[model samples]
Target: MHDHARGLSSGAHRRPLAVSLALTAAVFAVQVAGAILTGSLALLADAAHMMTDAAALVVALFASTVAARPADERRTYGYQRAEVLGALVNGVVLIVLCVWIAVEAVGRLSAEAEAEIAGGWMLAVAAAGLVANLVAAWLLRHAQKQSMNVRGAYLEVLGDLLGSVAVIVASAVILLTGWTRADAIASLAIAVFIVPRAIGLLREVFSVLAESAPRGTAVADIRAHILGAPGVRDVHDVHVWQLTRGAPVFTAHVVVDREVLDGGGAAALLTNLQECLADHFDVAHSTFQFEAVGHEDRHNAHR
Candidate 1:
């Protein structure tokens, strides 16, 4: 059962990586052409977003492949950290693009360049982009639930979807009101939407790289739970962190009472402690050091 589940998850991860790459490639081509033909800031901004989408998809594909590599002597935890690194790179790139878009939008807003928008053609192309983005978003939604790397790619695609919608609205406004500033307004809105999301992703990836505890999992709570176990006299040196997006690891030194320590009851107590941690904290990887009274020197050495 475990093997089958792992196989299914592996296949699921690969499928989205492939689909996202292909979709982003196609979307980029369409967006580039739209930008050239319409001369619309909104279209240009969408194209920039599509470029990031392609880059993000490529990073996600690479990360997923690297993450499947087995642990080696040099990399005790394997290549799983590659996904966090990829997400960090993608987040930084998105922030750069957002800043560029914002700067360009502000310049254009001040000068108010009159866009030579081919209203019908612009609308048609934007509608096509909207449909493509929606389809890509749908294809990636399932995979996003399975991995954080996929989720980052999924969010980029969703951002592109909003950019497409903004372009369509800008085209409509230009057609109806002959107002060129609407295009710049749409571009500004797109930048506003993307920057905060990029910053949020950056923060999360940075936390993972720093080996900080996973969000919502408190160290003190874990310590309390371990100490609450019967026969446990004290708990110290408790460490908790994420091994991957959803996989958490924990380690600690647990001191048992002298009676429990001498009688082989310590092993069973440790097992119970492991179960309690798993049940309460959803921590699957746990390492507990059983200690007798007056063993601080040995415990310190082991640590």
Candidate 2:
């Protein structure tokens, strides 16, 4: 049996996300100017990704706020899924941004004409961007653990953080060795780092959109456990899924012995079944349709 239950931590996700958004917006402004002045493709790429990060963070913040509203009659589950949609949108933006960066880096690498970069300007702006990314990482670190919306934001900032480091290294290289190719190389490397993480995020977002069962949860195991409860003869139509990150919900048709139904033990049996899911599977929200063994099979029955 699981000893402790898990729940969404409230009011904290927004703080870090909002702080990160402000910092990212500031860095993007500086980096765009730096990119133009320094003529560094790597700086330009990092700045571009930061643009997406800022936009994505705004969506995530809005979703988190909307997700907190209580469920109403017209919208039974409320707006909790706003976070999921935000995550999907963020993932799509990351992929599109990555592709653009990759294309530009390839063009730069293949160009015949070479351009001299202002390494000093590139390095200064990149360092500042790196610092901002670090601050963003620290602020959002805890929130990412329980919230997919925050995790999407965290991953974007993390990718930009790595992009900043790559820009700084390229700038330093060009400063010392006159290696203009380092700029393109660093941009390509940044794309490399971003693609895989973006793919992973898209997979998770797609899972939620598809309404698939939460990863690592076995429906067969859950069925067997339900059947093991006292007076339970069968369990069917067992469905388990996450309403969101850290929240698992279950529903099933549980058939019981007719004697148990007639003997006034149905309430106790229902409690046992609900507890089974709660204690063993960490499924706090469960609904079981209990019926006598023969009742469910009686197709001739009328309402």
Candidate 3:
């Protein structure tokens, strides 16, 4: 059932990402031409924004493919981390793009330059971008609910949609008030929206890569649960980490009653403990070291 669900999600995500990439590429080209023809900062900013959308879709497609690869000896955890890496890359790229846009906007603001604003073309291109991005956003919304990687891509498209709106409003203001500064202001607004979101995503991806404990799964609670099991005398060396976005793994040293080890009873005790952990804590993977009562000193010395 899980495999079937995963296959469906993979298929669903790929189609939208491909379509988004193609549309973003086309929009980027047109926006670039518009920017050059009218020397409009707002149009150029939107073009840059579309460029990042194209790159993000490409990353999403590649990462999704890599993440589907089965586990092997070389990568026992499977390729799930590929998606996190891709998200990190996308976030970094967005931050860099934001910086570039901010720099250009600042330069234009300093010069107080007036662009040959083509209000009609700017409005039309932005409207097209808004519609296309909305469609792309809707297509990925369902898939995003199931996967962090897909959610990252969805956020990127949503950001682009907002950029499109900003460009549309800026173009309107420029046409009405002849305030070329509106174009620079719109670019700055786009940068404001993009930078913090990228930073937040980068932090999340880095946490996963650092093998931080899974969210909402505290070490102290896990320790208490393990020690509360029957026949468990003490627990130490407890470690927990996320194996993927949702899967978690745990390992610990458990001291068991000496009698449980005699008469071949230790295996049954371990089995019961494993079941308890899984049922109570949602730990999918666990490694327990069974130790007899008198062996604590010897085990400690060996370690």
> Once superposed on the true structure, which residue ranges of model 1 sit more than 4 Å away at CA?
1-12, 297-303
How well does candidate 1 match the true structure, expressed as C-alpha RMSD?
3.4
Residue 35 displacement in candidate 3 (angstroms): 2.8
Q: Write the per-residue lDDT of candidate 1 for residues 1-303, one digit (tens) a residue.
A: 011112212324777678767877887788789878878778888888888898888998888888888779999767777777878888888888888888988888788446576766778777887888898898888877667777788888999899989989988988898887888889888989988888888888778777789899988888788778888877777777765676677788787788897777876886787777767877757877777767743435422
lDDT of 3 by residue, 146-250 (tens): 555766777788888999999999989877888878888999998999888888778777778888887788888877877887788887777777645555677
Q: Cα deviation of 225 in candidate 1 (Å)?
A: 1.1
Q: In candidate 3, which residue pairs clash?
A: none
lDDT (Cα, tens digit) per residue for candidate 2, span 125-235: 999999999999899898887778888889999999999999999999999999888999999999899889989988987887777788888888888887788888887
The lDDT of each candidate is: 0.78, 0.84, 0.77
- Off-target runs (Cα >4 Å) in candidate 2 are 1-12, 297-303
Per-model TM-score on C-alpha atoms: 0.90, 0.91, 0.84
- CA displacement after TM-score superposition, residue 65 of candidate 2 (Å): 0.8
Pick the winner on lDDT between candidates 1 and 3: 1
Off by over 4 Å in 3: 1-12, 145-148, 258-284, 296-303
lDDT of 3 at 65: 83
